[model samples]
Target chain A: MSKRNASESTLAHDTWAVEARGLVKQFGDNRAVDGVDLTVRAGTIYGVLGPNGAGKTTTIRMLATLLRPDAGWARIFGYDVVKEPQIVRQLIGVTGQYASVDESLSATENLIIFSRLLGLGRAEAKRKAAELLEEFGLTEAAKRPLKNFSGGMRRRLDLAASLIAQPPLIFLDEPTTGLDPRTRAQMWDTIRRLVKTGSTVLLTTQYLDEADQLADRIAVIDRGRVVAEGTVDELKLSVGTSSLQLRVQSPTDMDRARQMVDQVLGVKSVVSPEAGKITASMANADQVTDLLIRLREARIHLAEMSVQKPSLDEVFLTITVHGVKERESAAVEDEHELEVTRV
Target chain B: MSNVSITPEIRRSLKNHTSLSQSVRNSFTMAYRGLLKIRRTPEQLFDVTFQPIIFTLMFTYIFGGAVSGNVYNYLPIIIPGNLVQTVITTSIVTGVQLREDMDKGVFDRFKSLPIARIAPLAGALLADTVRYTIATVLTFAMGYIMGYRPNGGFGHVVLAGILVIVCSWAVSWIFAFFGVIARTASSVQGISMLILFPLTFLSNAYVPVDTMPKWLQWFVHANPISHLVSAVRDMVNTSAFGGSDLVISLVGAAIIVALFAPLTVRAYMRRT
Candidate 1:
């Protein structure tokens, strides 16, 4: 991992599919995107994981050259987004949160119109439209207007429309936000296929499982800032080790179990007497057996026990929640420091 | 999971980006899409086809006897005036439809494409010319059926029709500007109607300027709508060209296009 990081840092700017530095966007008094920086490698899926209003969409908009950043800059394959927006536009395809195809036009008509806009000849445009419709499984509904299309079908057509020019970079903003489980899986397959075709995809999603399943690298953004970024395993490991959870046979034994766990593991345990469960974080998996043996020697009855690695869901929650708390306490500390210095 | 094979021609076109001629071709393609929409939803034609027929008949019968002492005498005045009013009012759809398209995020798709920034707006305005033509022809046909005959020959009538369509197309640019800047489709329609109502009604379209109050006559004579109506009246009624009114109407349309086209494009670029 260290070696990979070193090589990534040494990669030339033109080789990176996307590079954004200190991008900021302000809407009235609200800074929708505040000092965001992103680097995406070619032919890889870079997932931006964040809750709503975390500046993921805003950052994507700026990088796609749809919205101008109030500060800083971005480059796509060494073409500056602001200075050479037309060339950058030629290189990227963007599928926004909303289905952006014309609802009044049929699926075939939508694809053909986009192809024609990309400078395709009439026969070529029609052939390409047919090919894309077949690939997206919309051949049967090609003649039907998009207003009659289901959400999944419309999204597929939207993706098909963006691929008319076969752009090297694609931006998908919450591509599966409202899709059902099956449709989301299909969409994920489509995204994987895009990457297989040598397209670099920058996707922003709020679902932790989505990033874990599809992203080569995930950036956790909270309140317009990246709070954590790494591979899924690295993110989970950053939150600390696996936890040991055990439910005592009797509610009365919960306190004893908690004390025994603290003594054996050298870490504080949280005991819930009502549920009769005691949980403690363990530094290593080998310590799990030691904990059980120590509790047994102390004659603590155990109804259940398990050691589980923290899921990416827990890591995301921990990072976002702790990030908010840290910012708030830091603000308070700054105020106190200001008072002290004034005196 | 594999990439779709691209023809060598397509690959070359993709690398060439967009030239001026390519932008114009793309704009027409967008306009063709707009026309296809109108074809599938034929009810969108009601505003151009039915509105002219209904308004010409209703206004001529209702106000003709009162304004001109007889329906026959009012035919000449009301027909041309109604043509101007109906076609100018038809221009409002350009902005309303544009706003609706923007609300549906269609412009978001266009913004990411390597096409001219003005293509969508230009295409929408171009497609609306068909609507103006329909309104112009229908207004005249309805007038002829109601016993109103223009002494102007076939050539003058065709010229008058072309003039009205061109002026309405120009007026649509202002509404397109409003469409780009307004918050909603309904608001765009509301604001356009608010601006158009006075301009259409206060002109000599329905009632002669002499019948209006002396104070109102000043605005009636000064209204650009009155100039267009007078221009149409001269061409259709007398079969004449080179009238001062025609020059004023043409200049007015040019000024509108020059003033609002850049403003609309600028606002559209910022939002997209």
Candidate 2:
């Protein structure tokens, strides 16, 4: 028995968990989720973050076996998503972006129905339903119709409903999209616990801070393609090394600070706003002291000087918006270059 | 013992996720859940209950005197015709409900679950059979209360009810395909009625087909609803059974099921 258990544990650990390559979904000429490659290792929260229409939901749906890829192959727990979809389904639970519990049915009954559908026996299904209701903090309202529940409670019920069978992988599509900040944090803790219990999760959300807070690794998708991906630190590094901020007494002092700072840092940019605050970025963290010393030596009176780590929002905007502009201009130049190449 | 218990569970779940069986099981489970929902909310029963009563009374009284010279005489023609029409028309709600469900993102949720791809569509199509049966029973009961007796006896009436329910179920599959493929519930219901109304109304429902003009008469004679109404009329009014009409009705039902089942499944597969 021990030998068999060891073999089973080894088999589970060695698998790539969920792997997809060259995924392309085309609706006519418009590519919705294009040329996406994703690998989510076992027992980690992998987040796909992007703005609306960035194909985050599309990518998650394909991974969950809802949509077939036009030009790629995908496998869940070493089983092909299309060819072995049932196996994939058994291993995973999915909570959609929308609340999907039957509105007329009571929360307890809804959970019981899904439990039975998951192949639990009648008594066992009820037991699982009760367990989930308690776990989701809805035991008091379990018998009430879901139509009467608040939005946050309904979302919790939806998540609980998905987990009745205790699936190994879960796909949560913007699970906390409309929740209050407190509820969102509580939900994040719940997700963290799921990961602790050996469940892998693939989540998609528009909130950059949510990805920064919850994801072990984040994949930033923009305009149907993955523009950047890594741990939070790695992604921040991709944008810049450090953030430099200087607060001046007046607007004139802010400009003087920028002028002195731009020369000292050798950075080509300056952002001294009308509010008498100057915040610029350096190429590296080591340049911050030099920046402050130059400002002090120039006799630029500073109220505040600080060096901070680059934020996820900064990384997101720098990578996504900048990438789009660069692509647009590159396309224009390519068109012109094409004419020149023809000439 | 542990090996015996755990391996099969894992294996069964894995098999359940990938194979076509997942789709079938998913569909059956969803249909079952829908039935449970109907149990919880009985308000949906209004259509099943009220439509049969109103239609039966209105058609039997309003058109009875002019068409057949008396209400009793009208019993033979209109009851059987109404029986066929009401049951078939009740099948339209299946498509409408499907449209509403899709609009509600029920199908969207189903797409992510890794269950059978066809389960949501198939389950919905199956659940409407209960609705079809309810309409069948209520219309027949209304017919009996109105002094329209089925000379074929209780056994034959039961057979006729089953026949209509099964055929309507087959017809609902066509509408179900439209529900999945159409943009809205109203359109699905509209498209289904646009095809059903002319076939039903122009047949032997209210007026005799022989009274119509030549071009119209030719269509009424060839209509599949005409054959079903004839077969039903022969069974209920005169206790007469064996004929080409009965054969034609069965053939029509089989053909509707055969043609639409695959098409609906194909359309449903392409939805995601």
Candidate 3:
């Protein structure tokens, strides 16, 4: 009972909806989720960005109380997952990587059953089921077995099921992994609506653009570790320099354009002669204007010219790739040290 | 895309969560779901209904003359035997269906809910009582149609049916344990059959124990299925619950449940 009071007081005072510290999960020889930490603020979407096998799902599972962490601890809305899983379960809803609904049951039946399990009365459960069906735009197919529904429909129903109790926090693991572009956009809208209604969300995805579009803060994970975590703009800036790209009017001017841009930017420009294009990284917005002025003075006409901010994709790639290279070099150094000791 | 407002009813439901009574209610809700699955796919009932009928007919006709000179005389022994065999074998469905549900990731959905951990497994076993009842009643009907009337009368015949259903439900806990621990549904089926085939066939269910060799007779007498079949015969034939066999059968079922129910629940908890 004192634990309940503690949780309630913490929930009122703390801005964090979910916090995980030094989480670890080992599956035999592979450290599926190595020591990881997370801090998700209330009423905002926090995204974990990673490629496959990056431990995103494992981390979510631990926070959702489905898997116990081997080392660290997590809390949802001030209730510790390990100590008070029941209270934690009460606070959070989880939509796993796969659609976890029963395919044999109709969509309406699925919703009603989940509502009942969440402590709704029979009539109330039915009413909520109908409302969720309508809300997810599945009212027309409510009576159809879930097996017949499209992938997007199933995913929507899955999300609807998690929302039946209107939990304060929701964990969506790879929510739009296999969805088509239009369906993914629709799901993003649903998520945005959910946030507007005052639900904190922890979303994990392999899509960099998805995190950039949805998350207020993002963490990039690779090989069971977080390599970088920050706002999208900060991550782009951390990777250093936007790119200055220009296309020459004629293919013959591509070499000239590349040389001039190289001299102005003090770096080699990537030249594509067939496309009459040259690209060079620039540290500041003023560099783009300076390059344009220089090109104009040299009488080099351009078909297209623009300074492009580096995409989150490039930031993520650079972070993860550099992390792997660092680890590899560290391993090499360890081996060299071992050789020296042996000698 | 307008924000969906939370109704007051939903807020109330969320606030008052996870009580013991709510767990019981949730268990029944899950059981109702299991029943719905069976209703949509009636083929799942084939083992409990048709298998019992077919096994009774096949065994009685094929071995009746050899064992007892006529099918009518053999009906007394074979009917109870078929009842026990069919009902116990039907318990394997619990584990198989559990494995199928797990494979489909339905149980993972259950894991996130605030309901009791045992609700889904308990509800699934409760819904399976329907299958056991169906097999119990059909085996008797098939027996009566085949000119095998139980002299124990209606009251005692029902007692025997109830006993078989209860015992079969207990045996299901064992298979359910297998289902939770095994890697796949097909493996659960294979492993359960490997254990059940010998228990049912090696007992004195279909034939008198005296006819077997002395060593075989020892095993036949010791077999829990033998005790269950004998208990069933005592109730259905004499209309009297007088024998020690009935006590042994009930105790055996209790022991199976006592041993495997926790094991199954523990394994299921880990997996989910």
Candidate 4:
């Protein structure tokens, strides 16, 4: 393969893998991406977490130089995304949620074409394609057209294609959004390995646990804005140390049980509109032991109860002063999180 | 190979400096990718194949006796005309396929690469030349089977084929521009046919311009396809390569390329 010298002409903003300020994109009257800013350190996996309409994809598109921002500026390894896009293009690789590999071509052909476009020699391109398919466990399907490949297989091949020359910064938008459990775990390993090998990664995901597992830091976006940004622990602490969810045995006894819960746990609870389930955040997880005893002594029977990390819904509740209408919408979004296709 | 690992510590900031020569090479590589797609699905060539054979047979027998007094006498005139008409009309596929290709997510990957922005579009247009060549050779072969012989040597016939291919390649750019801007593949085809039908049918492809009314004759002569057909006829019939008709067609092709190539590239860049 032919290698070109690293241009000394690049600017001094190379320390950070990505830096952006006031990035905005509008489609018609709706601003898909509002004035948003982000900074990603090198050799780290940064996650942008949000609901389905949170503009995470739009922000990544702007940073990858795929879409021009209507306003704002971004730089990739010291190159302006707009003014020095050619340099930016060289430094970044983007694997979108939709498989960007050609559907008509086989997996091997897709990799080779991507490699050849990056200036690899013919034989080297072939070798690289084979190696990637092998690494991605796609060697058996290398000669089959992408249309015949399953969703998990397509995702792996998509990631493989972007890693052809292994660009310094890779933007993986919802890389594991639609995969089965096994495939999801495989993708996580691949992403972790990418960072471990010295490539910085920026990934967007809707699943909170995905962000918790992979991201060193997470940015929670909602309705085209970053509502919260920090390490996952910081976000968890902001929501509360622990989440308490309980269902009462008798719907009529919910009020007494809620009162007992408030008196013992010292925290107000929000009753779900159905099933007499009460959700509350706790300052100290130890308070759960006291609340349970109070419920038992009141002769208030319980259907079920558990204390765990808060769902994304509770996080939205704590972070934003959303109205009842907005909160209902966020609850509706949580319903979607349960029905993973498991494909 | 089964033990392959992807954890190599690749140079994170591998600068890809694409010189003009590298851009050209990238375009050709894209063209090779186009050819590979064709190899996987050879049905894509059915248009170029069936159009030439079926159109040549149907047009020659149906129009020969009335237009030229006999089928035998009409071969030379009809063959060159059919070659020009079939290939120029076939150029519309370039734009249609381009629109379809861009609609897929694959082009997003292409746009993110450091190669020339125009490479994929240019490569697609270049690959369509092979389609034009297939139409040209098939039309000539079908004509020979139907008892037509070119007085001009095979060299001139090949030259005529090259001329028609060049012009059609240029005509494809206008359609490629449509492909870039039009929202759907069907719409690109719709708009291209709207523009091409009148131009191809009004030209002197199926009949002599003198047979039309005075007003119609002027338009037929002015039609760009007419200039191309007459140029091909000059080469195949009288072995005349230096005629003003050939110059007009070549210059027209050059002008179309100069105008639409960059225009299409600009539109493509904006969208991509």
Candidate 5:
């Protein structure tokens, strides 16, 4: 941790670090970001998670004042993104998916340029550049051109460049996309340190684990709209029930295991696959003991049996796939009922 | 949702949000950063330093005898012509650097920055002026070394140098626009040269356009490069100041900046 703080002189005190309503962005004929509504608190990590081509980048661009939304409005740190962009610019710093620093310039020079652009005096810019180089552990390479820095070093320098003036709100769009695991961890630690100092961050990433680790709240966007938004545990609960899997020693005993599971659950629909595995959805967690007893009485030698909950990947698949199917069938039923009514 | 476009509200509101002066200031800052990049790499100096030396020597030796009957006789003509050629050739760096920056994700980074959207594009053009000036001075110095005497002396030489620098700076916007829109850096260079070479070569640069075929003469006479070269020749070779060439050069510069500046800025702003 750099122990570097955004002093009153460097910080822009503002409320509501970011806010957006019905924001939309399009590229050519494709709606890259559909209508999105988001509100991030003053000093928290608001993580936007989505699959590739899910409009995360487009939404971020609109919020950062990089792209103009086709519809609706957005504001950052209490300033309307379209109407008060200069004030918005002064209050925020952005670290993009790729390193944006000039490779031809030394790391120190890169930071100094940013510092000057941020309106720092020449000496102040120099001092701030040195401070950033030290904080990012790039002091030794400060005088060397960024082209010679390794990937991880360049990314760190890129991040350091963004923090030169220590704006109150910072936008990081896939900041760790191409970094290695170790480098990614280092970058995450840096971000954690930033939050500790009360800087708000709007992070867009495809990595679910990253959201789980860092985000105070997560918004999962798909097809340009937020499909779900909640804490991790809350999202996991949306699937409705946990699943239990039992592996019997012999494939031939699968039918017997299925019968036992059906008897214990009082549901004739329990499934037993040819691989000697029995899986059942358990709405009541208290049935574990009865299920075990039934398995023992069936004389099925078990290799392994465990209770497990759905993961984020499973939750995502269920929502996108099953939810869509459920909607389609519901529409079909409504059409059928409408025909019946007309008849 | 599929048939999408930037709404009129966004366009109208962008003007309200982003001011022209602020954009120009942002553009200048970006250009200053580019100037810092040139300071760091310095290896980009090969063209400015080496080209002036080679072209000055080669043209003076190769064309001097056939045209002026002696190398010394051609000094006054060859020096100014080579200076114009070298500086203009150096303008190719505008597109090349822009392409390189775009390739290296610099523009992607710029898109996220909240500054004026045109800053990066404008800054890139600003930074290459340093390179053009270096070529201008070096070519003149090399000419001085080759025993070329300008009838216009030091003051006129300085004016001519400033003139070439300004013209090249304006010319660079054309290349900068190419850099922004071109798919690759090599292609920007190729395309810029495809437009530059014939204009410089066929003009009254190395020889009088009057001695050629009527068709060739007309093309040469109307070429902007001819105005620029004639402007330089009047200043350096004859110790005279003419308003016509200066007007042509300034008008040409104004037209290029007018046409490309807004187009480039608009395209650049829409990129994100």
Candidate 6:
């Protein structure tokens, strides 16, 4: 009890905090995460950026050893996630996209249970629970059951629970999703503080700006694959600063819509035939006004349109050149029957 | 929404050389958590507290005169019967609570920890003994209030109580397996009651077997619930410490646990 395992105590600086290769996980007929690869240097924040149902949580689950990969492999601090999980468990902490603390227990009790489970002495566990609750600004509600806490308070307690053991590598899965801006900013500060103190952090988020604010590197995942990976500047330059997606009212107008998009944006665009839509990368989002005006003048009668900040459905179309070609030539499988609910 | 199902993680691939002491400590900690839940809610004890008293009083009066010609004469037969029935029904709560506890997010946190895999399950099963004891004590007290006296003496009465509580704990493992495997908490309740109702009602727990038609009597006498009830009667009424029924009851409880504990753990481990 007085000594620690050598492997658990030693964390070499040169080791990558996270290394994953061609990882895959499938649920039913859905390959939620297909062939994702990532590498993060120690002492840096890595962001897995994706939109809803983009498999961000699934990939994080596999990395955290909560879900087994269908294929490929991952290692945390050079320990194989599958083969050396007990070692990996000792080396990492995980905070899920949802609050993981016991809802029926008070904030203090939840933290104490988590601490005791991690082998802390009973008195030490109690002290740590009180310390963390106060630090998270939850001291006032420490005695109240978690069911009484608000969303932000619950999320704070969730992170506080993860920090008890302070494992070398921490997984924060969308730590700020659904939070108010002030709370989100506070979470960001807390995350930055963790990395500053020598812990390597990996977070998943849907906001590109969040990645820009926190991550040293960002992986843009779409439909179960990493479409782009680099610093924020490099990814933005390659995927186009912003992109646009326009779905027409009818499928027959898709070809003509693509032509108008190419003429207005002055860039080639890809046609997603079944969706009756066209997607194009733009130098700036301000250029969207010109394209919309031109389509109106040409009487394209668009059903729906929007310029997006490289959302999950748009990232792969623009980042992967071969993916563009494949979609452009693929046969139209289904006609769009989208009810034009909006005028 | 982070709805993670049980995914097989190479079957504890992150193997730590967990000493028996650490496993025991982990189990005690988890059990403590279970006890905290009981204390916090307190209402969770309502079934065990109220159901036994209701059954003991209801069954003694309702069937007492019809079965044995008077209420006092029926007290001896019905006390043990209601004891077995009340405590066994309480065992089903173990499975129901376990199912309700496994919200994927909380379960994910549990799985990510390095403690012994069985701690949470074992702790939940152990904490349920509190419920069993409550039901056992209440049933006996209700019998005492209704004028039933045990010639087997206070020691054997206590022995009878321990035997039922122990058997209920063993029976709970069967429900614990259902908890891990069922898709919903309500389904666990439905399936547990489906299995328990017939087993309890059709046995000698509530009725004399000879009065039943011959076809039903065959199944009722062979029912394991009957063996448990008979064992309790032997201990309380006759002070027969080592009857064949007692051996059968003990062995039956052992077999139930041995068969269901691993089966439950296996189903829980299938994180696909």
For candidate 2, write residues B1-272 as lDDT tens digits. Answer: 01111121223324532456655666788888779767877887788888888998999899999999988888878877888899898888888887787776546656656565567777877887888788888888888888878788888788777778878888888888898899988898789889999989999888987789999999998998888889888877667787899899999999998898888878877777
The count of backbone overlaps in candidate 5 is 1
lDDT per residue (tens digit) for residues B123-143 in model 3:
898899999999999999999
What are the TM values for chain B, all candidates?
A: 0.93, 0.88, 0.92, 0.93, 0.90, 0.92
Give the C-alpha miss distance for residue A39 in model 1, angstroms: 1.1
Write one digit per residue (lDDT tens) for candidate 4, span B1-272.
Answer: 23333332224443445678877988898898888888888999999999999999999999999999999999988999999989998999999999999989999999998889879998998888989999999999999899888999799899999999999999999999999999999999999999999998999999988889999999998888898899999998889888889999999999999999999999998984
Docking class of 5: incorrect
Rank order by DockQ, top first? 4, 3, 1, 2, 5, 6
- Taking chain A of model 5 alone, its TM-score versus the true chain A equals 0.84
Interface root mean square deviation for model 2, in Å? Answer: 7.5
For candidate 5 chain B, which ten residues in a row score worst on lDDT?
B1-10
Candidate 1 wrong stretches, greater than 4 Å: A1-11, A247-270, A287-303, A329-343, B3-18, B207-218
- Candidate lDDT scores, in order, read 0.86, 0.78, 0.86, 0.85, 0.78, 0.82
Candidate scoring better on DockQ of 2 and 3: 3
Interface Cα RMSD for all candidates?
Answer: 8.9, 7.5, 4.3, 4.7, 13.8, 9.8
User: How close to the true structure is residue A263 of candidate 3, measured as C-alpha lDDT?
Assistant: 81
Chain B alone, TM-score, model 4: 0.93
In candidate 3, which residue ranges exceed 4 Å CA deviation?
Answer: A7-13, A250-275, A329-343, B1-20
* Model 1 chain B weakest lDDT span, ten residues long: B5-14
DockQ of 3: 0.43
For all candidates, state DockQ relative to the true structure. Answer: 0.34, 0.29, 0.43, 0.45, 0.22, 0.21
lDDT tens readout by residue for model 3, A76-172: 7666888878777777888988998999999999999999998789999999999988899999999999889999999999999999888888999
| Alpha carbon lDDT at A235, candidate 5 | 84
Q: Which candidate's lDDT is highest?
A: 1
Q: Which candidate, 4 or 6, would have the higher TM-score against the true structure?
A: 4
Candidate ranking under TM-score, highest first, comes to 3, 1, 4, 2, 5, 6
Q: What is residue A219's positional error in candidate 6, in angstroms?
A: 0.8
Which regions of candidate 5 fall more than 4 Å away from where they truly are?
A1-16, A246-277, A286-305, A323-343, B1-29, B116-118, B215-219
By TM-score, the better pick of 1 and 5 is: 1
